[model samples]
Target: MNSADGAAVVVGVDGSEPATRAVLLAAREAVRRNRPLRVVHGFIWPLLGVPVAAPAGAPPHAGLRHQAEQLVADAVNAAQAQESGLRITGEIIDGEAAAVLIGESPTAALIVLGDRGLGGFASLVIGSVALQVTAYAECPVLVARGTARDTGPVVAGVDGSALSRAAVEFAAEAASCRGAPLRVVYARPGGRAAQAGEEERLLAESVAGIAERWPDVPITREAVHARPVAALTEASRDAQLVVVGRQGRGELSGLLLGSVSQGILHRSACPVAVVRTPG
Candidate 1:
């Protein structure tokens, strides 16, 4: 299915165990959003090398195409098994994985990916595709990691910027959907009591209307005088999901991701959702 038809929860699969986890999570998200689940596999090797003719009159690049198609089929079947009756589709695109997923972002409700893939090193904190898509995707991107059964608060990093406000709204909706609490965290360098009080006020202002929209979800606010990354990382230990903006007020406007966001993606103990500021 083409993304133009409707917004879907798009997932990238590579026949890895982590990819299976991603498909399962994406399936649940599609059901939650009332959207279809589209499983995509990027076939870059065929573009990099000349196609070779196969035996028995098979088309050139038949083996590679077959493998890619099977990868997509397996992902679709796994997702359907996770949630019976879920609408799911599969496709094999010819491009780099990150580029293909980013190209699909505009029409996707959300892009879900595994934290690491087969090509990723065990020593690496996160995969390159996960990092790139989280930084560049216009829509929110979720990097699936850790256990999915964590029944904790939906933690969000708030800094009173437009992007932070957007993240707060997203977190509120996520908390409402998951039947969990919303924790808004504001972290700043060591400061005076007056500064701490001012930050608290700003945090309250940022989340003012969210409670009205999600009255059933419990909301808690915390203003911590510490590094943003440290505060957010500590909060993520008990969080079911951590939400943050791609860039914040402290970051340069042109940068794709700020230091705090990059740090959280690398260190967060649970699944992290990166939301970009709406134009």
Candidate 2:
């Protein structure tokens, strides 16, 4: 597929089982969006002691490059098997995995990565690459996690912040595409009835006009006097996907990620999609 035909859905693969899962999920998203799937494998052969250059006319780090190429090819094949007739392409680029994926964000509709990579420890809930990409990517980043067994509403954390508004927009479209209902939630600390009223208004304002844009998506709003992390994490227990802004009001605006986003990332029961507010 040509890059000119809208932004492609990009997935990073590293020859890990989790990466294969990401490929399948990304392939389905590409098919749903009617966009191409670009499967990329970031390779750093020199870091592994592979020579960057060989004698004239000879391939440089041919063995390492070939392995990277094979990884991309396998991911492509798996994507194809997941969704026949999917427009797909594969590339092996030399760079840090997070850097390569983040660089692709400018031309990508969504960046999908495995919750854990080849080097990630089993104790780690999210790999470093996934966390870095999700925190910095210009476009939305979806961390493929947990089994795709639940068929529940698309849950979104809404606080009326600019970033949360972006997350609501993204969640609305995602729900519309999947024909799933949307659950917009706003969590406030308990203690004051006056604050509860204010949060209710915020929740309402955050989701205003969503039904107009996504008329087919049924939306349900919740304003609870609970901790943001605890509320959203519990909502994720049965959600098909949990959507959150890259940053929120809890931290300074200059921060790349807020406490809520980080909390959900570490504890969400379903896949998490982090949407950044557009510049």
Candidate 3:
């Protein structure tokens, strides 16, 4: 993690693969946004509730702190190596990891984490840290799993209804800032869900219309098969940020979030941005 300057992206490091992935993702984001990255490494004397007594000749908490400092130093070196221009700094915090991370999560721009976390079973489908960050962070939380997105378009799910526009706007702006292409995917069921290419074509036109508002940004368009939830998930499989319209439907529209956004929040590999526009 780098020192904080203005708005920054925060990542938690624990010397695990997930933690390292989080570090890499955060570094790339910081470099792209031109903002400093804040790396926070926390250590607790207790190992999952078991306390260790200090060895005969060691000072109290000395061993823990030393190990923690070394761990954080290694994480910092790896991050700086990946992004040469990245400004980085780190510290060893004392306390519970999840608590310290949330307490220290950067409120400036975004928070990035690994899909799974440093703690818990390695074979599990999800980790406690990812779930915790998403539920509590003030700023939108991004969890990168497996391969992190370096250069790819953003895939967002939306309908032609009222709430759809909000997701589109967010996706467009995000793509513009990253200078990556924007792919707006409207997933509709077969048969009566949408009239062939009509809905998809309309969606493309709508995204194009929004792009006019930002003369400098580049946005692309698309539509897909299957239900909105499944289609969106498939589309976002290779995307950076999976943006989705919440509480909306092609049948009726208002200030409501649909299950599509909710479902993706839990399963997507990349981070999800759930946007809801008022009726």
Candidate 4:
């Protein structure tokens, strides 16, 4: 199913620091979109058949279920603190983290996640749940990472594909919400002058519709003569968010996410949103 109109912004929390950060970011997005915020925590103990209830003499709140409930409560509280007026709800689902979030995606306005979680490997830039959800979620997935800057342009990477066009649309809306400028970036390897002109044309076409839709949103274009990942990552250094398509041009059609988008998710110095264009 696709995300319906007026869907909520759903965020999965594991009580990890990264998850906590995601809650704040999600709350902000919920306020910006004027949508409700749904905080979810995946409860695996019940699914694993582990006795979730407390021992015979223990208190009800001492059970695994209680702990899961408490986690969701905490996340909800955090989101509320971020924005008092935001409508918030919490849920504890019996499933894996990634699966639960993916299940929520079809009806979510957006899915917000953290770069890493408690289960994250120190060597890995992003957690398994974050990567998995980003690749499979039906809606845009925003991985809150690096510095959550309050001031910076909304950067979007385009490859002149339908998916990239979706990214531009999403980015334009984000920029308008923040009253920030939208920077459209196109990265190509060759530095040939002839290619520069083509790259400029592609960037212009990518933002044409979005620019018209968000006329109040100032738009700028950048043609980078570098690898897609490197160029976007560099552009993200001072950006509030870097938006990219689930898959880009020249990528294998079978791949759920393009290499450029994946790389930005890992290396971006700001939040990254991967837009999965709807059919």
Candidate 5:
């Protein structure tokens, strides 16, 4: 999904290492977009039928509420440290983590989440919270993973679909903002020499307006004879950000995320941004 104009960059934190990384990345994104940063902690204790207040005679900060507040406080502090003079705020919302983030997504320019968090299964490549938010959020969802690098090209996987073109638009803006080169990759699994011309033409059409829109950003188009997931994952090896459409051509209408998009999320070597045309 696309971001609303002038909206803040929202990030979810849970006191995990991955969440901490997400905070810093969100801060960077906010600065790049010239928008404010909002750090949100989804507090689930109140919704679990547990007492939110501390027991009588107990320490003032003994309640789960206090801990939740502290988590947001610490995350806000960390984000501010990462980006001094940046407009940053924090909140403790009573709801499920994924639900809270999705609620914030409607008014946010971007939603940033950790690939995995404390609530996630250790063996899974991506957390349930992250996946849920990515699937349902109203704005684009960025999952921070692997090494955080700010010095690589911005990669976009396009297939000439409207959603793929939308992803290309997002990638162009990201590349322009970072002053990095933009690589638009189109992967065609069929290795037919006779169809090479058609594939090349479609690739060009996918990124048709990107150059005119972001004249300063260098654009490269590549047509690969490989699976989309494999090609994009390999490109992510040296990319600062990888953008893909949540649902693309040939995907089932009921699926929130296309197979190639999900594969990229699970295997990309850099941060992954899932985009779709906002309603």
Candidate 6:
């Protein structure tokens, strides 16, 4: 979402199919925010014990660094070509991909990353780097896939946590910008009986409550009894944007995201925005 005074956007590029989508999204956001953009590529030679720099006559490190550099250049070029006056900088950092991205996220208004990547185990976790970055980035992180980048309503997960309140605010602003309805989700479980008497809050009430706190915008809510991550993902599968707060609640160790946020990052069909506000 574009902050009123504009904000910088940072994106992680690793020459993956999903990365192109992230770059495009980040560029668009940068333009909208009217702020600087950075196309970051974190590099570390594969563990094959292979050289990474060019030999005397051979290509540098068998062209590893060269290829990666070219890839980053192309990504940055593509992103910058679309928007004039965009301060798009490309950074080639060495070390673990996820770690560096997290390192740079401190000053970033938001960190943009792909839903998945080329390397690492697949099917469940998306990829290690993407997963780790979303979980620990200093600023809010938006994880996008190529397909989900095009656009939808700004959907946010609300769990009554203070963090979720921040997410709702962010989602409301995004939905307003896109002129889309806001979807608020709270999940518990189904097919179970509770106490004899209860004054349950309607799912829609949550969304309505948040909407009432902000500027007028269409709002919707859902309360289902299922896994928080599962329900949120399934409900927002067709949504354009889904925002959730990082679960790093009280008394946590140095830098940690909640399990639900981490789980949704890997499984949500739509691009997920994990918002983390400083304590």
Off-target runs (Cα >4 Å) in candidate 3 are 1-5, 44-56, 59-62, 159-170, 195-209, 245-279
The total number of steric clashes, by the backbone 3 Å criterion, in model 2 comes to: 0
- Whole-model Cα lDDT per candidate? 0.85, 0.86, 0.69, 0.89, 0.88, 0.75
Q: Could you estimate the TM-score for every candidate?
A: 0.90, 0.90, 0.74, 0.94, 0.94, 0.82
Identify the superior model by TM-score, candidate 2 or candidate 4: 4
Which residue pairs in model 6 clash with each other?
Answer: 52-61, 53-60, 53-61, 54-59, 54-60, 54-61, 152-240, 189-225, 190-225
The predicted structure with the larger TM-score, 2 or 6, is 2
As a TM-score, model 6 comes out at: 0.82
State which candidate has the highest lDDT.
4
Give the alpha carbon lDDT tens digit for every residue of 1-279 in model 5.
Answer: 233466899999999989999999999998888889999999888889999888999997998888888889999999898899899989999998988998998788889999999963678999999988888887888999776698989999998788788889989999988999999999888655635388779888998877888999999999888999999999999999999987532345877888888999999999999986654
Segments in model 5 whose C-alpha atoms lie over 4 Å from true places: 1-5, 190-196, 248-252
Q: For every candidate structure, what is the RMSD over all alpha carbons to the true structure, in angstroms?
A: 3.3, 3.5, 5.4, 2.4, 2.2, 3.7
Q: Give me the runs in candidate 2 sitting further than 4 Å from their true place.
A: 1-5, 47-49, 52-62, 247-254
Clashes by residue pair, model 5: 1-276
Report the C-alpha lDDT of model 2 over 82-195, residue by residue, as the tens digit. Answer: 899998999988888998898999879999999998994888888999988988898899988775533799999987888899999999998887889999999887875654
Ranking by lDDT: 4, 5, 2, 1, 6, 3
Please identify which of the two predictions, 1 or 3, would achieve the higher TM-score against the true structure: 1
Q: How high a TM-score does candidate 5 get? A: 0.94
